[model samples]
Target: MDLVLLAIVVGIGVGIVVGALGAGGGILAVPVLVFLLGMPVHSATASSLVIVLITALASLPHHARRKNVDWRNGLVFAGVSVVGAVVGSRLSALVPSQLLLTLFGVMLVAVAVAMLRRALRTRAEERAEAEQALAEDSAAHDPAAHDPAGQEDAEPVATHDDPVLDQPGPDMVDGADGIRHHHGEPEVPLSPAAPAAPRLPLVIGAATLTGFLTGFFGVGGGFIVVPMLVIALGLAMRRASGTSLLVMVVATAASLLARVGTEVQVDWVTTLIFAAGSAVGGMLGGPLSAKARPSTLTLAFSALLGGVAAVTLVQTLLG
Candidate 1:
């Protein structure tokens, strides 16, 4: 296939993936530029940052309108991450490409494993909830299910809709992508509660690490940021995803600028064409993501990570 054609095709896919999955999208870009487009790894990484920045910007509005973004928190994370990105970009010049590839392969495997584990856990939790609901229904219908004292009036068991249980569950709609609605399930509304004290440190640490990776590898840092938001900060998955794009815009811009005239060199013609395709595809991915089941998406992402890891490992080993 013609190289320009290939870049355009791959760019669209990368943008959609970013819109759908956030951070991992940049991983695909680096490999495509290196192996398919015949660019050196360093140059590919720098170019990938530029593409990632544009894709994030393109996808931002979709999530923003859905109220998925936490601008204050996003800015905090982005601020710290930008510092790390600058440091990482400078260090990238000294690292051997082979070593970088090996490290990236390892990182991919780790992400795949983490994704698969989370998927399995989510499935198990859903199953448990179903079983509990069934048991409650059975108990409610049983003649002897009343209070042992046989009081004339008894308190009813609280249901999923109870205020106490109103906390977001795994199956809760993360409609940040603007597509997957379940029988009119409402979007998980954002809480204005302050993050816990412990969460502040965790967010700082994770954001810093995410930024460093973005600069070093020319990735958008969404994969790491999204999960951290979900796990550490208690943000809904959709909110985490939307907020991730906001953070990426800043971090990637910093990383790209750091590489100017230093690490990233490209044929502006091919780069521009690829970026345009990516921007268009990014706009479409938000709606598609809303339709996808979280479990299904997680499993698919896991598989993709594993496949990429295998390919990277093999290439790095052979080279």
Candidate 2:
């Protein structure tokens, strides 16, 4: 009963991280299970996958309702990633547990650094935009700034036959019959043009790499997937976070399926309880995430990843 309670508490924390950032559940879960729960590294990794799978699945509806999930691109990325997941799962078994954990720690540190840099860049961009807006607003209210030549004080010279008014405006063009026509106005409204397709090679490469990491380290791969969706697919941060969850569902499922007959022993009872707590946390996190600034979340999450990585590395080295 005590262990079960602890699992639930841990799950909720992990779930919140996963839901808010659209990743980090598995990254956090594996180490927690190994260090706190005293589970073997292999079992912890396998169990972490289950926890991430459930949390991602649970949080997906919230993002979907917000129209954040890019279904077409997500599906394509997931489909290609499945193949990589299968291959990675097969390779995971041959690697020793110590080396795997070491690699995980190193990967976490690298991801943390990358996220920190991105957060700083986003903050700078936001600050610049705010300054520009403020300047524009000030200029709009200042009459003198707009009329440095003092043209506003000059009297208006109106004429009955103003040549300027008779001339065609920027939107007007002379027709073949020498009649001026409004080129901007159409007889009928045209449908909006379709969005340009994402770069295929980049999508494929990113998906494959994410899938491999998911299967090998029992991660959801959302850390990588979210960035790929944003940079390669041109999705907004919120939408990319949501779409990453969709990709994680598929990747985690594939990785888990590949381990079906493996020797990895999972604590199903504990896993289920943890997943239940995570589901509830995910529900709360979705709305909270919508309210928070993306750069703030990124910076906070990166700090978390760095702390976890440092601890994991220290523990492994001591052992």
Candidate 3:
């Protein structure tokens, strides 16, 4: 097959993977080009960068339209990621690209396993909490028990809807006599925790490292980016996905700029054609993402992560 034709085909595949899984382009792009098409890793990495940049660009306007970019947070992480990518890209020229892929493959597998563990743990916790809530509700509803002074207090931790209280709620316990039985009545004060913006620094650190790997190895960071955002940064799946695409858009652009004068090869024409396909595909993706159920998304994401892990494990051992 012609190299440009091959690249365009791969680009469409990468775009669909990105649209569906939110990250997997470079991993798919590199291995296919290397083993199947016999492209050298170095050239493949450069070519993968082209594919990544184009797909990322294609995905960006959709995310921007959805208002998930969080530019301030994106800027901080993107700045760090750009630096890391430049360093990683420069290093890519010195070290063997094959070695980078092998290392990256391991990293990808490790992240997938970690996320699977976290997802299981989170689901368990949510279930346990729900069960406890049900038990509590049953106890509180008992007709024989006295709820004097509404002592059977049902306190809900403040959410986005209500103002957070500075001081604890009145610390008086309910009395059996339907009133404060005595002056020394003890009340369990509700603990108030501060709500933080989801875009935290530690999460950004993960994003930066993912970008470095993506830019350095020519893989999409979606596997790492989406899970980290959902599990660590507490972003919803759609938001994490949208945010990941934006970050990719920034990181890929920066790396491409660095590679412009380098010895790395890029088929810009092929890359553009692939991106043209992705633009239409991605327009359809954003709305689908918004409509998908969270549970369905999580399960689907878990399956995708499992696949990536299996691919990485096979590739790493083979390499």
Per-candidate TM equals: 0.82, 0.84, 0.69
Highest-scoring model, TM-score: 2
Off by over 4 Å in 2: 144-195
Q: What lDDT tens digits, residue by residue, belong to model 3 across residues 1-319?
A: 4766765565565566576545666766666666655667777777777776667667767767765555655555566678767766767777766566677667656665665665566556556656776877787778644557666574542211001111221222245543321123322233335233454666667767876786688766776776666555544455567777777777777776777667877555644665565554555555565565444444555566567656655765675
Best by lDDT: 2
- lDDT of prediction 1: 0.76
Q: How many pairs of residues in model 3 come into backbone collision?
A: 2
What are the clash counts of all predictions, listed in order? 6, 0, 2
| Candidates ranked by TM-score | 2, 1, 3
> Candidate 1: where are CA atoms >4 Å away?
134-198, 261-263
| Native-to-model Cα distance after best TM-score fit, residue 263 in candidate 3, in Å | 1.7
Let me know the TM-score candidate 1 reaches against the reference structure.
0.82
User: Looking at model 3, which ten-residue stretch has the lowest summed lDDT?
Assistant: 158-167
lDDT tens per residue, model 2, 113-147: 99999888877766665676688689779987578
C-alpha root-mean-square deviation, each candidate = 6.0, 10.8, 9.0
